[model samples]
Target: MTDTPSPLTYAPPALAAREDLLAAVRFDAAGLVACIAQQHDTGEVLMMAWMNREAVAETLATGRVCYYSRSRKGLWRKGETSGQLQHLVELRLDCDGDTLLALVDQLGVACHTGRRNCFYRAIRDDALTTIADPLMDPAALYGDAHKGHSHG
Candidate 1:
């Protein structure tokens, strides 16, 4: 059984403004949008996740970064199992209104591989190079729960 998300209770004026902002967003044909999580203080880009309208609403409602997992086909709360929760500091929308930027105070590692961020690889000397070290064991974090999980 799935747990119903608690309704987002926000201040009246803030809620109205948020409603307006949400209304202005242009979701893609698949009812999904790209939400890029960025470090709140250092301005470092963390991981990118998919967010439908419900995900966005849940994020605002909870102040915890939530995403729609394509693999699970359900709403995924960040760091739920990994202890790498992202606390939303600010939310921004691009001029095109199709993409979202979530500035957050990330805890622990952001990547499932135990890296700080998913974009820990870079093109160096014309070759892809790893840029960060794994902070923790993903096996320790998730165990065999996600063993069958695959990125499509």
Candidate 2:
């Protein structure tokens, strides 16, 4: 009933030119794009972060995932302090090119709260419930220097 090509037999459209990867993305007014990091193998969503042009470029060049931190107002290289790094496996752009999905190999906990991922809380029975427990103590991960500040 539809003319759409089957996913099994679908082929990617040819690019008009070999354009720069950054040029294909549409950033926000703050020159930032939303990026979702997911477990490469298990398909578990790790965390969400913002990426600027510089972050994207650096990630591609170094094969390391980098994010722009609005709180720090600088580039936040994942696992720089917590030892929980996210290695880049594949970077995918949405159809609108406004969001990016980074398939990654997470080294350790992906949350500042010491959980496996950032999505620990879920709404249950009309109340916010804590689902996942911290894998490691926050102090152990960041030490006293980063006491109050969030890791993400």
Candidate 3:
């Protein structure tokens, strides 16, 4: 990925007024909003996840990225079990206030598959292809806890 900063980079809103700011977001019927994480410096799109109100507040308060796990039905602190972590640089709301963009400083691999990001497959030459390989083994990342299991 290029190191160049795109036009998306800007001064984030102050956290002092976070509650009021968060009130403006339009969460869906499930009380969740789609969040897209991107590398703050390189502008590499990392992953897309869901975040609820509590997740959003926690992220802003702690400066650590958090998401809502629909399957587990709880707050998922990104990379809590694994060494990989995402430090929030900024969080932006989309124009419709239904989507969120998270500018983060990612540590290690961002995917449970041990890849740098989740978008590893691509449509290439009229066929689906694996564009990126795993940087580390999935077994190494999650150990026995995730053995024979796959992320949904």
Compare the candidates by lDDT and give the number of the best one.
Answer: 3
TM-score of 3: 0.87
Write down the lDDT of every candidate, Cα atoms only. Answer: 0.80, 0.81, 0.84
Off by over 4 Å in 3: 1-16, 147-152
Clashing pairs in 3: none
Q: Over the full model, what C-alpha lDDT does candidate 2 score relative to the true structure? A: 0.81
> Residue 71 of candidate 3: its Cα lDDT?
77
Using lDDT as the yardstick, the better of models 1 and 3 is 3
Per candidate, the number of residue pairs that clash is: 0, 0, 0
Candidate 2 lDDT, tens digit per residue, 44-75? 99999999999987776666789998888899
lDDT (tens digit, per residue) of candidate 1 on 49-127: 8888888888877788888888888888887876878888767899999999988889888888878888888999999
Query: All candidates' TM-scores?
Result: 0.86, 0.85, 0.87
Question: What would the per-residue lDDT of candidate 3 be over residues 28-145, giving only the tens digit for each residue?
Answer: 9999999999998888999999999999999888778999988778898998888788988878888999999998989999988889999999999999999999999988888996
Q: Which ten residues in a row have the lowest lDDT in candidate 2?
A: 10-19
